[model samples]
Target: MQSQHIVNAYDQELRKLHSYIAEMGGQAEQQLREAMQAIVTRDSDLAGKVVREDGLLDELERKVEAQTIRLLALRQPVACDLREVITALKAASNLERIGDFAANVAKRSLALQQMPEIGLTRSLGPLGQTAGEMLNAVVQAYLDDDVDGALRVRDRDEDLDRAYTALFRELLTYMMETPQRITACTHLLFAAKNLERIGDHATNIAEAVCFRIRGSLPEEERQKGDETSFAVVSPGILGDGPTR
Candidate 1:
């Protein structure tokens, strides 16, 4: 029957879309890991490689978008089928952003190498590790279609946020204590922020996975722990009494 053949073709196309997403997710995670390693080791070559490799994720995202558009137009998918297409689109978008952020970290690492290494640079390793772990977990959750695993990833984002906030404060204090370190610290700050953003995009992917499987987003608002905006570091606290 023609109807049965068409349905089978549509299912195959959906599987292809999922394949694209999985590939993108894997590439993005590797990018983040390499970018962090590049920073820790102060290897400009590795950082440059990460920047150049970002194009692959960009191309993959384009492929996902094209595939989803074709499926939407030809199949007129609805219900669960519609969710599959939309979730793939969303996951691809998030993965692309994660790639962009990883590339940003790599770029910052290049800049950081030109300056004197600061003590705070060491702190980024742990932060980046947490983000990389989160990304890896969420991508796995998406591939497994495990709504519970995805939810766990979502809940874990707060830990990354809190870690970032703590690092931000430490960088601020370090900058105030030694003005000469400002330039290097600023680069590290941006690099840390990029890693933090990677965590956020990973969380976005987890939420998308939840929606795809459960048909609705989590009911309660996810808690946020990033408190950088309210953080203040008084220069007076660093040295002698308060300055007039």
Candidate 2:
């Protein structure tokens, strides 16, 4: 009877840990969406709010870390139970990084607000939308423990990379066309890069989900779709470059 009581207590702790992860996942998704909204609307106040919210994410990460350590020390979980705890630790870390990236996008929005609006913002819209969708999908995969769904989510990261590569080329073209646009263009480029990184972190979460389900990480190379190096240039515009 004492052993059964101990087992039930351990199970209860694991369930609480899972619940915390779900809460953190929901907040991460909200942060990504609101960050993109702040950029599209050029709302500094909204952007500031996103930045401030990072503190909550940080606090949540710390909570997950402490809980994980407590479980490792007290429960000494093994096999699948061990994997569940470890994966939760890893997923929380990835989610924390994703939150940081969203805050970075918000910071970039402030810089972009100082300059004239450019057409590159259209490209950002699609890129941010794709990344946000990937994040939502990966979170769902983690929640459902669907290994096939996690694999599919991992594959979708290539779409975000392609969108980011295209946006990079378009922004470079804008900067080269007008020297005065360099400052704003540079900030926008950083913002787009942050969105791309968020997609990468989402892929990381998908991998964590796979680990939780299979007890091992994927052994094969991740299929990548980034093609930034071969960006096409306009005719007779090869000599153009952004001026500092």
TM-score winner? 1
- Report the C-alpha lDDT of model 2 over 72-157, residue by residue, as the tens digit: 66665678877887888888999999999999999988888988887676568887888878887887888789888888878889
What's model 2's lDDT at 70? 69
- Candidate 2 has its poorest 10 consecutive residues by lDDT at 235-244
TM-score of 2: 0.91
Model 1 quality (TM-score): 0.93
Q: What is the lDDT of candidate 1?
A: 0.86
Q: Which residue segments of model 1 deviate by more than 4 Å?
A: 236-244
Q: Which candidate is the best by lDDT?
A: 1
- 1-244 per-residue lDDT for model 1 (tens digits): 9889888888787788888988998899899989988988899999999999999998999999999887776676679878888889889999999999999999988988998877677789888888888888888898899988888888888998999998887788778777887888888888888988888898988988889999998888999989887876776554543221
Per-prediction TM-score to the true structure, in the order listed? 0.93, 0.91
Report the C-alpha displacement of residue 100, candidate 1, in angstroms.
Answer: 0.8
